[model samples]
Structure formats: C-alpha cells, structure tokens
Target: MTAGHLAVIGLGPGDEELLAPLARRMLDDATDLFGYGPYLARVRGAPGAVRHPSDNREELARARAALALAQSGRRVAVVSGGDPGVFAMASAVFEAIEAGPPAWRALPVEIVPGISAVLAAAARLGAPLGGDFCVLSLSDNLKPWPVVTRRLRLAAEAGLVIALYNPVSRARSWQLGAAFELLRQVLPPDTPVALATAAYRQDESLRLHRLRDADPGGADMRTLVIIGSAATRIIDRPDGGSWLYTRRDVPD
Candidate 1:
C-alpha cells in the first residue's frame, strides 16, 4: 500500500490574494488540513479537506497528528499564516519527522512557500528592511528570557534592521516593553519604528513611532513590529503620508 503524503503550506498574511498559486493547488489536493483556527478558516475553496484547528503554540502536536494522517494514506496539508518556515509549522513538521515514529520518516513531505509577515510589513512600511535585517520572536515560550534579551541586544548592537514577531499576547505582555528598553540602550531614542498590525487584513493599521515613544498597546498577537536600523530614516511624503526606508548606500 502506498503511504500518504504531507504538504506544509503558507497562507500568507491574512489576505487571500497573497496566497501562492502552488499553495492553493496543494490545498486542492489535500484530504485533510491542520493548522491554527484562524489560519485554517482562510482555506475558503477547498471542498473536501477535513480541517483540524488547534489553539496557538500547539505546533508539535499538530505536526505529529498531520504526519500520522499522512502515514495512514490520507493526503494532509499543514497550514500556517505566513511562510511556514518562519516561526511556523514547517519547522515543527521537520522536528516531528526527525524524532517521531520511525515510520513517519518514510512519508513524503513537501513545503510550499508563502509571503512572510515581515516581508508584507516591509512593503507596507516603505522598505525599511532594504539592508541587512533580522527577524526575532519576542515570545519566550520555547526559549529562556535571557536568551531572547541577549539576541535583542546583539541585533541592535549590530545595527541590523529588526522585525519582531509575536510581540505581545495575553500571557506575555511585558516582553515588548523589555525589548524596547534593551534596544534603547544601543539605538537612539528617535530611531524609526513601524508597528504593522494585521498586515493585509481589515482593520490593518501601520503607525510610525520613535523607539522611545513606541506604545505596546498598539500591538497584539497579529502584529509585526519592525524596528529600523541606525541608518533608517523617515521622509515626509509630498502627497500626505510619511515614508520610512533605509537607504541602500552606506557612508564612506
């Protein structure tokens, strides 16, 4: 008997238009879908796929369950909001394959790429990530707080444009404040910061703030907080709104 196959797909940042054609095709072929609830609801036209929606931070269990379905001759698709590889289901699926039941290793697995939230945020913010950038998750659920804080400090010191994901949630609210505090130690108080909430969804709001003046109240689980590098700057637009961008060239 032929074993089932698993496809990990990225649905993009809350917009149907942003989903890739290949990902849509895979969803069409899948018999089962597994993902966070909100992300699973985005698969509008997949007629026969059975969806298994779980709460946040349950990635490993979800990956294992999806793989088991695949091993049992059902084509399974694991969906994530952004690129699955970016703090999403792709790594969880791989981690399952590595340490799961040995039979799981034999199943065919594929990952379909999608536009990440950071990229979507960058486009909305006038390309603040034009130079070297780093994406970090502020949630310390999987790692220690010291480690997260250390990386925040090091990334700021290195002057890399930083895109912070999962900045604030119900159980963990103070991390964003602490992150801003650490960044302020190495970065100027007036450094440009863009908080892109709900990137492509309805109620989307993108606001520019100085590092010192950044308001944690502007962020939620759906937000992508982008802290600009030292070289990043804002330009007042002739039309109306301001543009935040990092120049490609560096001073001699």
Candidate 2:
C-alpha cells in the first residue's frame, strides 16, 4: 500500500480563526490542492503545493482528478468552504469512487471536517439549533424541487428547526421564497427565522425575522437560513434587538 493519500479538508466558513488545526495542517502538508477557485483562494497552502482550481460546478471532475493524483503517490488535498463532509467535496469524491475503477476505492482518503455553515451561523445567532434540527440544501442542481419542499414540510411538521444551505442563488432565487411559504404552512406566523450571510466573515450579517415577515430577497449564495421550530424563542436584549434560541425540551 502506498503512503500517499487524499485529505479532504474544510477551511470553515470564510474565517481563518474558525479553521480547524487539523485542516490547516493538512492544507500545509498537501503536495497538491483541488477545489473551486474562490475556496482555493482562501487557503494558505504549502509553498510548493500545486492548486487545481476549477469552477464550483465541476465537483465530480475535480474529485476524479484529485483521486488520480492521490493514487499516483501524491499527497493531495480536496478543500471545501465548510465541513468537507457536509454537502461538499467528500460526497463528490465518494460518488466518483463509487463509479470509478476499483483501484480508486483502495486509495487512502481522510475526511477532515471543520466548522460548518450551520454551526457557524447557529453560534452567531445564539442557540437556534439547541434542540432537534435537520439541515437541507435548497439547491436543485441534483435533487428535484418537490423533494426539497417535501423535506421542508416534513421537518416543520415534526417541529424540527431547519438549517437551509444554498438558500438563494442567481439561478434559484425563487426557491427560498417558496420554501419560506411552505414552512409557514406548517409553522406559526411568529416562528423565528435567522438569516446569516457570510457568517464569521468581515461581511457577515445576521438578521432575525418572523416567518410571516422574513424576506427571501436578503439571502445570497453565502447565506445560511435557520428556521426555528415551535419550541424556539426570542429573548429581547437589554441594549437592542434579540437573541434566538430553541428550548432543549419541547414542553408538553
């Protein structure tokens, strides 16, 4: 067995402080790095390391290329914005391995997870995810819209806080509005929704709104929308605004 391997690492949510120590070490130790251009730009890699920057849409191809490099006895790193396992390169790499030659499966691959968008946003917004929650990506690139809406309805019906990734993009702007409306059907008008954009970054913004009044227009590609369950509450701050949180126990 070759000592060369693949390290799939997460850089965290656009903030270097949130980047995990193991992930930072993996990036510095990598002989090669593969990821989207913007995500690759965020990394400070080894001086001699080669970066294979591709468009965000080229996940599978990038996964295959990284796998090939790793299989050839190179220390390769596949980087993602947040936790690599959560809706990122790890899944893409696994999909490529599943369909690729059997040798690809034998390649040593390590998943180094870091702070996810959901966790980052939740931390910024207090304890909105203190209790049960389900994370979903609203991007319809691979899944059907019906499936997305179905899961949203089910999560709301079950009184589960919903952390939505990829809430709005140029191509899917309407989906978030539709999702908000769907959640409203199952949740209350006063349900708290936290819109966290570019969480932990210099441009980070966190806004809280009731489900009835939350605006879908505020979100962008970098936003993580957390919709609270029935058990979620808002505590008005003495200074101004409020903190959003979910009760650990659902009262009977």
Candidate 3:
C-alpha cells in the first residue's frame, strides 16, 4: 500500500477557539489519529478519526502506530495539546519515523504550529518574554539530571527570562526545588515569576508571584513557570490584571 501523509496538528492549549482552521480541517480529514488520551478527548467531535491513545511511557509506541497507519495509506493526524514542536510530540514522531521501515521514510510530513504554553503564559502575564528568553523542561525522563540542572543554571546566569515546561511531577518532586535553589544563587529574591496552570482551559489560573515566594508544592506537569530576567518588572495595571515586562536595553 502506498504510504499516506502525516499531519502533525497542534490543537492549541485546550480552547476550541485557539485551534487553527487548518488544524481542525486536518483532524476532520484524518482516518486515524495518535496522541495522549487527554488531548484526543479534547477534540471528541473530530470526524471519522480512530484514536490511538498512549501514556507518557508509550511515546515510541504511539509514534510507531501513527507511522504504520500512515504507511498503510491512511490519512493520519498526530495530535498534541499546545504546539507539538515545543517540548511535545513532534520529536518523538520524527524519531519514530527515523527508526521505522524504509517505506515510511518517503511519506510526507507537515507540522502545524499552535499556541505553546510559553506563549499562553506570557500572554496571560502581559509580556514577560518581551526581551530575550529561554525555555527549559524540568523533566529528567529523557535527559540526565545534571544536564537539566546545568542548563537551568546557565540560563539563570545569562539573565534570560526563563520559561519552564514540565516543572514538576509526582515522580520528579525535587527537581523544581533544586531549580529554585540554583536560580536563587544567581537571581535576587524579589525577581518576578508567573505560574500558569491549565492555561486556556476552563479551570485556568494565573498567579504572579516573586521568586522567593514561589511554592512548587502546588505545581504539576500541567504548570508552566515564567521566571523573570533581571530587567523584568511587574506593574500594577488599573484594569486589575498585572503586567510583567522585560525591558530591552540597547547600547548607545
């Protein structure tokens, strides 16, 4: 059978309104789909799509299934909540394709970008990433702890506004605490930080706090942390929502 194409659709955070028209159209046209179960559930109304749901540990399996379906000439959409390219399923899909049968290699692949957690968090808290920023994932599942720690420290030392994905999980409870300690060594206690939970979802909560006051105890895999650079400032807006801004200083 001739291999079918792969459409990597980023379904956005969770709001139906955030999904791009093209992404919705692709999902509507897919005969088979692959993604984490929760993400698939969000788009329950998508037509004629067979979902292959998998847990975090089954990423390789999920990718392989998607690839296999595509190779069989079935239009497949690998769904991801938020943008797949930003610390999501895109890498896993590429890795699976690289490791799959030769026939799968020639299949066309398209990545449709969506609103990443970093962007959603930044939007909720004004423009904390107006200057330069770096994104770091605290999950050490795929990478070594030392490497994650090193990048966190380096990004902090460089004074880049940092957006943290996968901040903490039940199994990785101490990683965020260690990251806080490392940031404290380089940043002031009063540095601004924003915690966006379940962004763009019905239960969304946005909390703007100081670095010293940030408590990772309430954080989970769904939380996105925005740590301000030295130049980032928090201003009280007359409209009730606070604005976090990172000022860019140009050389004379």
Candidate 4:
C-alpha cells in the first residue's frame, strides 16, 4: 500500500486571514493534525481523526509522530505559526526524514507556506524591511548563544535590517536585553526600531523607537523586534504614531 501524504503548513501570525489558501486547503484535507497547543487551537473544524496537541519544545517528537501516522497511510498535517519553513516544523520534519528509515523518504510531503511574522510585522510597521534584511531567532534552545550573537553582530555590521524572532521568554528574559546591547555596539543610538506585538491580532500594537531608547523588558514570545540599518527612517503619522521604512537606495 502507498504511504500517506504529509503536509506541513503555517497559520501565519495570529490572524486567520493571513493564512495561505493552500495551507487552509491542506488543513481541511488532512486526516490527522499535529502541532503545538496554541497553534492547533487556531485550526477550527478541521474534521480530522484527531488533533495531536503537544508542548512547543517537542518539535522532533511531533514530527516523528506525524510521519509515523503518514507512513500508516493517514493524511497528516503538521502546523506551525508563520511560515513552517522559517524556524518551524518543516525543518524538524526534514531532519526526521533524513535520519529515519529509507522508506520514510518515499512518503509524499508538501510544504504549504504562510505569511511569516517578519512579513506581517513589516507590513504593520510600514516596511522596515524595505532594504536588505536578515531574520534571526534569539532562542538558543537549539543552537548556542554565541552563534546567535555572532550572526546578530554581523547582520548589523552588514547594514541589514534585522528582524528578531523569539526575543524573550519567561525562562530567558534577558536575551532580548543582551541582543539590544549587542546591536547598540554596532548601530547608532538613533537607528530606527520597531516592535510589532501580536501583529493583526485584536491586541495588536506597533511601536517605533530609537535604538538607544528601545527597551526589551516588554517583549515576549509574541513580539517581533526589528532593528533598522543605517538607511532606515521613521516619519510621524497623522494619528501621533509613526511609520518606519528602510531607504531602498544605498550609495556606493
């Protein structure tokens, strides 16, 4: 018997409208859905055999479980927030496939992309990513902190707009502070910064600040932090807020 199909999808930030049509279609067609509790909660009326909700830290375990279901000829869908390919379950699934039995490779797998947090945040904040940009996850759960630090420094030095994901969590409250300190070392004090929290959600809030004054204490897992490059600019909005963007042109 042929192996079942597996589809990995992203639900986008926190809004249903941001979800890609392809991802919604896959979710509807899936016989089994596996994801973190919060992300799985975003899916309504899936009509699947069951929704396997697990902790956020169990990516590999979740991926393997989903694959096993697919191997048993069940249409399985693994869901994540934002683009699954971006620091999400797609990598975990691929890693499992590469190390699992060769038969696992034969199963048909599709990646259904969705609006990443960076894009959603950039849109809400008026295009801070208009120029070259780099996306980094500050969580050192999978990688060493030094690696993240080095990448952050280099991205800043290269004048790339830096979009930071998972900036802070309860267990690691100091990471965002440390990250901001690092950025301050290379970037000017007045560089534009944007904090997009829960973009598009009901409680969504976007704030603009200068690098010197940006505080990390308020950021959480739901916040996406943007550190602008030299060319980034911010203009006051009519409503007393501000819009930020990076100038597309750069001199030689």
Candidate 5:
C-alpha cells in the first residue's frame, strides 16, 4: 500500500461557489491537481498546486498522473466537473490504482460527490425528476449502439423519467435522433421534455417542450435532456417558469 493519499473532488457545474468546502480546502492544500483542461480552468487560485491537463481520450493517462503524484507522497486533488462518479474520472482513477503497484491498493482515496448535471437540470426544470428516473449518456463512443438502444427502450417502457447526458455532439448528431425514435415507441408523444443547455453557466438556456416536438438535432454535448414519464404533469407558474410533478398513489 502506498503511503500517500488522493482526493477526488467534483466542482459541480460551472460556479465556483457550488464547490464544497472540503473540496475547496483540498484544492488549496494540494501540491498537485489534475483534471480535464476546461474543468481545471475553474479552479480560482492555487499557486502551489501544479495543474496536469489531459485530453478526453487520455483517461488512463490522467489517472496515472494523479496516482503517480499521490504515490510519491504529494497531496493531489483530481478535479471533475459534475459528480466524479457519474460518467466522470472517478472510475478511471480507481481502475488505474488497481492495475498499478500493490502499494497503491492501500492509498487513502477520498471521493467527494457533488451535484450532477442531471440534478442541476432537474432543479432548473422544477423537479422534473421528483419520481423514478434513470440517467443515460447518449454517447456511443464507449458503449455499443445496440446496448444504448436497449437501455433506452427498457427505461422508456418501465415509465421511468429519463435524464440524458451527452445527448448530441457534432460527430454523433444522428445518435440522439435514433434514441428519440426508439423512445417514442414506448412513451407518449406529448411526454414533457426539458432541454437544459450549459446549465448553471452564464450562457445557460432551459427549454421545456413535448417529446414529440423536441428536436434532437438542436442538442449539443453540453445539453441535458429530461424526459418525463406518462404520469408527469407540467404546471406553468404565474412567473413564467414551469414545474413538473409526478404523483404517487396513496394506498387506501
């Protein structure tokens, strides 16, 4: 077991204040921090900590860098936007440690969870996920398309509210449309759908539309789509905001 320790911190969406007190303290005290380029830029001022930036395809490399620094007895903070355990680098970190030196198995690792994008989007749309929900990433880069499609079908058929991440990207535009088509087979055409773009960021945009009308082509990598179940109701607030609700039947 390595004598060093590593702290994995989630920075939330884009706001610095959303960072937990513990995460802020770790970032401040750490001698080295690692994260994707965009997520790393959010850290305010930590002159003592050296930043290690990794591209999207270098998950293993990023994990190795952080583990190496931690194994060397340096306090290291690995930053991830949203919740690290949710489609983030937390798993990669663990996988790297498991595959490395035997001492790494004993390293003290702390995973501090943060607000995920789905939660942020749900809050923005007024509790769209107040009931049963499932989060799915539309990016088939890692998972096969068949597996993604099957999960979508099952989730839709089970009437579970859906939170979609990485819905659409430049190179994978058709995937969202395909998913939409699959979902429509099991869900009502008028099911409420919330498209949240760059959520919690300065350029945030939130749009509430019916599943039948939501254009998947308009979505981007930063967009999160919340598709309500059949029982979900949309109430328009007098203040021009909308609220979604799912009622549970009380046993008589």
Candidate 6:
C-alpha cells in the first residue's frame, strides 16, 4: 500500500500570479486542501480536491485535520497566505506532528516554499530590508505583550531594520502604537518607516513616513510595517515620491 503524503504550501501574498507553479501543481494533485477560507477561495476548482476552510485563528485544528487526511491514504495540502515557514501554517503543522500519534511521524511531509509578505513589501518599498533585518509579528495572541516589546527593543538596539506583521486588528489596535514608542527610545525620530498594506492586491496601499510621524491608525491586519535602521536613508526621486534603502557598508 502506498503511504499518504502532506504538503504544506505557501500561497504567496494576495496575487494569484505570485503563487508558485509548484504550489499550483500540488493543489491540482491534492486530494484534500486545508487553509483559511479566503486563501482556499483562491484555488478556482481543483478537479478532485476537497477543500476544508476554517477561521483564521484555528490553525492547530486545521493542521491536525490535514495530517489526519494524509494519514488516511490521501494527498493533503495545507495552504498559507504567505510563506508557510514564515509565521504561517508550517510551524503549526510540525507542532502537531510532534504531539500527534507516533505513526504520524513516519508520514511523508513536504514544505513547498512561496514568496513571503516581507519580501514583497520590501521590494515595493525600494528595498528597505536590503541590509540586516528582523521580522516580528505584533499580534499578542500567541505570545505575551512584554515578549514582543522586548524583542522590538533589542532589534532596534542592534540597529537591525524591522519588519512587523499582524500589526493591528479589530480587537488589538493599540499594540502597534506601543511598538513605535518602544522603538523611538532606541531609534532616531527621523528614522524611515514603510507601511505596505494588501501589497500586490487590487486594494494595495503604500506609504512612507518617519518613525516619529508614523500613524498607527493607518495600519491593519493586512499591513506589513518596515522600520528602517539608523544607516537607512531615503532618496528623493526626480518624479515625486521617495525611494528608501539601507546603506550597505563595504570596502570603498
């Protein structure tokens, strides 16, 4: 009997064109698909794939269900909006595997990579993260508030450009503000900050501001915030808008 397999696939940001070809083929060949409702909706119609859509917060349940389907002699694909390994379903899937039945460990599990939001956001913003950087999720749902703040402080002190995910949501609106305040203590007020919302999507929005002037109100769950390091600088384009980038220090 052939053993079943599980594929944790990244669906890219929002644009379907950004979705990797390997991911598309995996979805086409999957017997069962699992992901948040909106992400699963992107797959027009896989011939024989059964999609199991769930709420955004129910990751563990989704992972477990996908694993179970794979164990039952089915080709399973667990989809995530951004790169699965980047604060997405990949970690949850592995966590479930570690805690699941011993037989589950022997199952063939593969992770197909996809373009992450940070990379897309940075590309749209003139490479603000071309230098050393760190990515942080501002959502305190899985971790403590203090832990997030501490990391922000340390990243800022280390002079690393920071990319923030899940910056704001309906229930959690003030955390982004607190994060900015914490960075203000370590970074200069004039530090460049880039806000990219729904990047590459129809409703995409991009904005640039100094650290002190950044408005947290503009942020949302779909937004990815990039804060420039001390070495970062903005170049004014001859047309109008500015291009922000971090200076790469090398031999003269």
Index of the highest-TM-score prediction: 2
- Per-residue C-alpha lDDT of model 5 across residues 1-252, encoded as one tens digit per residue: 436779888888868767788778887878888888878877864786788887877888999888888888888888888898998989999899889999788788999888888888777767777678899988888899999999999998887898899897767788888887888888888998888988789989888888787788667888998888877889988998878766553224
TM-score of model 5 vs. true structure: 0.94
Write candidate 1's Cα lDDT for 161-238 as tens digits: 999999998898999988988888899999998999988888889999999898888889889999998789999988
Cα lDDT listed for each candidate: 0.89, 0.92, 0.85, 0.90, 0.83, 0.90
Ranking by TM-score: 2, 4, 1, 6, 3, 5
Q: 1-252, model 6: which lDDT tens digit per residue?
A: 668999999988867789888988988889898999988888654777788999988999999999988999999999998799999999999999999999889999999999999998888888788789999999999999999999999998888999999999878999999998888889999999989998898899999999988999898889999999978889999999888888886223
Local distance difference test, candidate 6: 0.90
| Residues 1-252, model 4: lDDT tens digits | 656999999889867777778887888888899999988887864654589999998999999999999999999999988999998999999999999989899999999988998999999988788899999999999899999999999999899999999998768999988988888899999998888999989999887889899988768789999999989998887898788989999888
Choose 5 or 6, whichever is better by lDDT: 6
Quality of model 4 by C-alpha lDDT: 0.90
CA error at residue 14 for candidate 5, angstroms? 1.8
Higher-scoring candidate on lDDT, 3 or 5: 3
TM-scores for all candidates? 0.97, 0.98, 0.95, 0.97, 0.94, 0.96
- Candidate with best lDDT: 2
lDDT of 2 by residue, 30-149 (tens): 999999998898789999999899998899999999999998899999999989999899999999999999999888899999999899999889999999999999999999999999
Preferred candidate (TM-score higher): 3 or 5: 3
| TM-score between candidate 6 and the true structure | 0.96
Question: Which parts of model 1 are misplaced by more than 4 Å?
Answer: none
What's the lDDT for residue 193 in model 6?
91
Clashes of 4: 0
Give the least accurate 10-residue stretch of model 6, judged by summed lDDT. Answer: 243-252
> What's model 3's overall lDDT?
0.85
